[model samples]
Structures are given as C-alpha cells and as structure tokens.
Target: IELNAFVAYQREREAISDSAPARQLFNWCREAGLNARGLEHALLLRDRIGAVCRRLGLPWVEAEPAGNPEPVLRALTRGFFGQVSIFSSGLRG
Candidate 1:
C-alpha cells in the first residue's frame, strides 16, 4: 500500500514518469487482490489519498541497525529513477 502511495507521489509530482513505477504498481495491485479499476481510481486521487502517506511519513521499515538513513533513501531514489541529484545549493524537495 505504501509502495503504491509512493509511486503515486512520484508520478503526480512529475518527479518521474508514470511509465516507470506506475505500470508496475498496477500489476502489483491486481496481484494483491485489489480491483485494477478501483486501484487506479484511488491512485488518481493522489493529492487526497496518496499524499497522506507523505504527510504522515513514508511507509518504511528499518532493516539494518548500522545503516545510515540518508544513504538508504538515496539508494532507493536512484534505484527507482536511475539517477538522482542533490543540490548543494540548499534546495528542498
């Protein structure tokens, strides 16, 4: 659920094309027992539904005690989009 929400966020914000994760998410939803139409509709309501996850914080679990949080996040972002840029100019996402 959280993964879908995150995908919704990235697509809606234009941070990435929906083609990247959005198609994967649709297939995932069908496998997870959700009706594809309903899931798509819900994802379309990203601002009200999906954004809640971002507002409340991402759906995440720490798997390692020794890992740094920032690197893990950077890794995920890069894995998802293939490239990432961190502004040394103090830009906030």
Candidate 2:
C-alpha cells in the first residue's frame, strides 16, 4: 500500500502495535520491484468503498476502528497472500 495511505490507516485505526504489517508489505513490494501506484490505488478504492457504504447505509464491517490490525492482516496474509495477485488480475481482466 501507499506508505502515506497505510500510515494514515494505521493512525486512524489507532494500530499502535509493533507488528507493522503495512511497513512489511511496502518493503516486500519494494524488494519485489512492484509499483506503489497499484497499492495506492487499492487503498484509495478501499476508502471509496467505505465512503459508498456509508452513503448507501450499508454495513461496512471491516471499517470498524481497532487498536491493532496485526492479527487480522497476518491471518489474511497467511491465507490469501499467494492468491491476491491472481484475484486482482482476474478482476482487472
């Protein structure tokens, strides 16, 4: 994710843990030579979805603020990290 966007998310969620999932992901992107633009777009899309859900009066469960997102992020990474690229590409195509 965009470093700025992730940092903003971490701050907004009060995610003050040492886990640093966003940092790790950003580092992985850099190491893998992936562009930050894609991650930034994803983060922006997340924001837009949250906004739309609010506007439409739909429950956006994941938007609930939490003190830490490490556990969730870690679990999701473990479960679907490998499939994310394929899933995203599928969506684009």
lDDT of 1 by residue, 11-69 (tens): 54454356666666556555665565665565577557547777889764543554345
Note the Cα lDDT for every prediction shown.
0.55, 0.64
Q: Output the number of the TM-score-best candidate.
A: 2
List RMSD in Å for every model shown.
16.2, 10.8
Which residue runs of candidate 2 sit more than 4 Å off their true CA positions?
1-28, 63-93
Clashing pairs for predicted structure model 1, backbone only: none
Positional deviation of 35 in candidate 1, in angstroms? 1.9
Candidate 2 per-residue lDDT over residues 1-93, each given as its tens digit: 224455554453354346886676566557656655675676788799899999999987642354357655675697796798888899997
lDDT of 2 at 55: 100
- Which 10 consecutive positions of candidate 1 have the poorest summed lDDT? 82-91
